[model samples]
Target: MTTRSCLLPPSIIRPGGRPLLSTGRAAARAALIALSGLLWVGALATPPPSSLRGADAACVNCHRRSGLGSIEGHIAIPPIAGPYLFVPRGERLAELGIPFVDTARINHDPYTDESLARAIRGGIGANGKTLNYLMPRYQIDDATMAELIGYLKGLRVSPSPGVSTSVLHFATIITPDADPVKRRGMLAVMNQYFVDKNNAVARTKAPTLYSSHTTMFRVERRWQLHVWELTGAPATWEAQLRKHLAAEPVFAVISGLGGSHWGPVQRFCEEQSLPCLFPNVEAPTGHDSDFYSVYFSRGVLLEAQLIARELADAAEPANRVVQVFRAGDVGVQAARDLQAARAHSGQQIVNRVLPAHATSKDLGAALRDVDAADALVLWLRPGDLSALEKVSPPTSRVWISGEMGGLEQAPLPASWRAAARMAYPVDLPGRRVVRVDYALSWFRIRKIPLLAQQVQADTYLACGLVSETLNHMVDAFVREYLIERVEMALDHRALTGYYPRLTLAPGQRFASKGGYIVRFSDPQGPRIAALGDWITP
Candidate 1:
């Protein structure tokens, strides 16, 4: 029921006639602890006595709710969990029933209650060295400080259920609506990646030590992949995912496959705080606040932006833009995005949505109204593109989705190629030949059928990314750390297949940023030409 002013330190008066601390330094240290421990106080001029979650909020922002800490640029925020802080410099954490993390310093001496308090108040480590400048000094009373340290001692991060001394388990999800070819391709890449990983680890005689320390050594753990194939309707996918996750606990979801709706899968990952990285889905969850899911791009949404940019800058743009898509498909979102983008541009946007299982006969109805003064935007799959033979396209301007229509191989008829420009969200085919063909060669060697080229290539890239991140992680198997490491390492990768260059950061879920608007160079063939330089719109 009591509150304290944020400007002032922890109350000087103690309840029940008890001394908060024996010395003035200890009292100041407690106030310092309270100041550093609770971040919410800074936002309010007056904070309640219970603000730091009172005994429950030892590690706040930056360290995160997981207490696993985070990295920014060159600064490594050390883990404050019980095992990381209390263990001796020469001791192995795993042996002490503690999980290992690369962020935890093994060379640092162990901390006692008194030394820990001194370090908290004075900004000095147990080794008598000053801590990083990013770490702030705080002020709190003695009793509260003792309670905070006790809370930290109680915070422990033992290995998750999927992690073990000899193996690390990961799951790849496949929705019932996912394309069969892409599913097969993703699983093939994941299986091959695991086999290659174990073989490489086997070559090393022993787990390599990170530094010249007896306590620190990278334990060789074989990668284990669990396939979660979800059946039934989209509404039930999240429940099915929960059941599968409970039945087979995986450290994270990697390189999955999905179709028109990946919302259930996205929800499952967000709710569980499970890392779902780079699943091959055209329409991914658009919520930017969700941290657990990352994608290669905004899928069709990025294409919408690309098309909108082209439309917005035209010397004499179309007076009316007509967009056509399936009723319940990912294209629906893409069409809506384009409409919103060009809303105030004095262009009348029209949406012609066909049924989910629309036949070729239905194409005529959607294209009937499009004419010379209107831009025809097609948010459709290869089947729908092929169905366009039933009707002629408008003479104004035509934009087709390269991703949904199968990239350069989009089955648009020869008649349409001269007029239609594809929203190509990857590097040009000629430039990406070496990058893509390298994966194709590997597929041949492994005897994995290359049915879905883009899906397979992206899956291969995702597997390689996970492997590289784990190598950088050393022996740390923390789930949150894995996601953080992937974010940091993605930008440095030089061999990103399919995509021009993949990149991600703290809040960025999509890796590839932009693409080109291209048209068929020759009417009869698969070769395409870009209209201009890359645009990130």
Candidate 2:
């Protein structure tokens, strides 16, 4: 081993007001005399074996010791064991210079002895400067340093895994003082329903016709285009009526529109009964009477059935299935038609009946108890349909639902997307005939020029049967009640784009005496295939 001197310069060592002494001072004299006796004893003793003098002993002394000069608040420093020594391989200690270790330089390339020295003394490696303020410089002779480097050189080097470069958007919605987490949940549902895979549109303002005033304002910023606000209460009967009226102007005030503070609108309609469209709301619950007072006509139901049948045919099932209907006259009528089809084909027939307000669990249980069947002829409200989907088992069961139409709300739940599939008789607004009618009607009624432009730019091609029926009624009321264009325009045909015909007879509700069937298909997404008109068996 090479010997080295460890000394303090005269300027660095100063005793209290004492002059430099060539001869012994009182303190120096005492210390020198003591040291001389110790030196004499140490010269007689044998030195420790060189093989036990490992270079790593110096680093372990501080890093491995429990309390020896450890940085405050930090845990014990890690040992420089394995392949990585104080100085890594392939780095040049000289390049790190004096005070700064080139950390970046070392990171850019491989480690080396020179780099390790820089990291240990200069506080930086090839990259210049290591992290942390507490790491002290190591004081060692050249021979020890070389021995340390040689030991580190024998260690193996392994690369770390690559880090990711992409960033997430964390799509979210903002509700009025609502909990941030709940708002995010709402946004996630909306994204699942409205936003497609590409995420081209971040937010869409739902038509006010659908949203509450508060929700409308909150969502307006997210909407890319249209901003329609709903003006009435939510989920209440009155609100339902108002929404129906706004969407379908010809809706008449059938009885029962009252009893729930609907007295005002009902009274106003009754006063103008001759001009206002009034729906018959009080027809006997289970009777087949042609009560035209407050109900939709059989003609509408017949048309819906025709459409359902046609769609079923298009679907092309192997077995003839019975209709599952509600326990009422309308259900009976639907069941009668299925019976007729069965009679004609000489196939077995059956029927399942349930109460009007059956829950999804109830429906699912009822379906399970039924004899094995090919399809379900569903006739229920949208809410009922949603519930049924929730509880019903996922089988290869095809459903020909009553005219419940498509998904219209934003932030649709994934469960809803997977379960609900049905059709409507009316052409949705974005399509050709419906578009023309929407534009023309808005121009005629509201005299709003912008609506026509809006229709031209963004329109949807899906309409509910009830909506379509309402449109037909409105057209008839306009031609007969308002314009008095009573003479049937001979040679006039169904509008090219509208699903139902424009013409009307005394009580004839609509044309295309049929409905459509919708199904979920991965490749085509949601598809609607048209059913033909209904006919007497």
Judging by lDDT against the true structure, name the best candidate: 1
Error of 1 at 238 (Å): 1.3
* Candidate 2 Cα errors over 4 Å, as ranges: 1-300, 307-322, 328-333, 340-343, 370-373, 392-397, 405-423, 428-484, 487-500, 505-509, 521-537
Question: Candidate 1: what lDDT?
Answer: 0.76
- Candidate 1 lDDT by residue in tens digits, 309-408: 9999889889789899998788998998899999889889999999998888888888887788889899999988887886777764999999899888
Across 324-409, the per-residue lDDT of candidate 2 in tens digits comes to 55664245555565566446554455576777666666667666743333444555544555555454434344454433222232
Instruction: List lDDT for all candidates, in order.
Output: 0.76, 0.33
Give the best candidate by TM-score: 1
Give me candidate 2's TM-score against the actual structure: 0.33
TM-score of each: 0.84, 0.33
For residue 284, give model 1's deviation from the true position in Å.
0.5
Worst 10 residues of 1 by lDDT: 9-18
| Model 1 misplaced stretches (Cα beyond 4 Å) | 1-38, 41-66, 69-74, 89-103, 106-109, 113-122, 139-151, 201-216
